[model samples]
Target: AQSVAQPEDQVNVAEGNPLTVKCTYSVSGNPYLFWYVQYPNRGLQFLLKYITGDNLVKGSYGFEAEFNKSQTSFHLKKPSALVSDSALYFCAVRDKNAGNYQLIWGAGTKLIIKP
Candidate 1:
């Protein structure tokens, strides 16, 4: 079975500080890891993906993630948070052998930025 857990319900940050939303996953085979962001009433937008090779992958909106295989974790990060950066985030994983290519998604973590 494949699954993902986002332990935090929400993350609160100042407008210009660093922020992180935790995520962990379990999968049968090599996993295709992804991070996505969603604005209210909008569909998720692809932030980044880790297929193979690099442990540290960078993506849109100045976000990056570190893939920790031993811990089965992939945590999202940013050098500086923005007020506009406040949004809902989801971590997803797909099995390499799964025929449908459907992504197993986390519930989501709401990021709140204070002015």
Candidate 2:
């Protein structure tokens, strides 16, 4: 089975500073990692994903993630975050049991960006 986990319940970062949200995975083979951000009263918004290719991938809203095979980590990052960037973030990976490679999301981590 494939799975993903967000180890932190919340992450705090000051505006303009870099921020990272941690994610770890447990999978049999090459894992597909996806990151999403959810604003209050809004659905999730796709950020970026690591399917295959370069280890560092850039995505929407100036967000990016680095895939580390040895560490089994795909952490989301941004060089500088804004106050509006504060939201609930989720990490997901492919579900092996599903025929169509549906994603199973981990618990969300609240991001707090202080001005």
Best by lDDT: 1
Q: lDDT tens string, model 1, 41-83?
A: 8999999999999999999999999999999999999989999
Clashes of 1: 0
Give lDDT for model 1. 0.94
CA-lDDT, candidates in order: 0.94, 0.92
lDDT of 2 by residue, 1-115 (tens): 6778899999999999999999998887778889999999999999998989999999999999999999999999999999999999999987444557778788999999999
- Badly placed stretches (over 4 Å) of model 1 are none
Per-residue lDDT of 90 in model 1: 100
Question: What does each candidate score in C-alpha RMSD?
Answer: 1.0, 1.5
**Model 2 weakest 10-residue run by lDDT:** 95-104
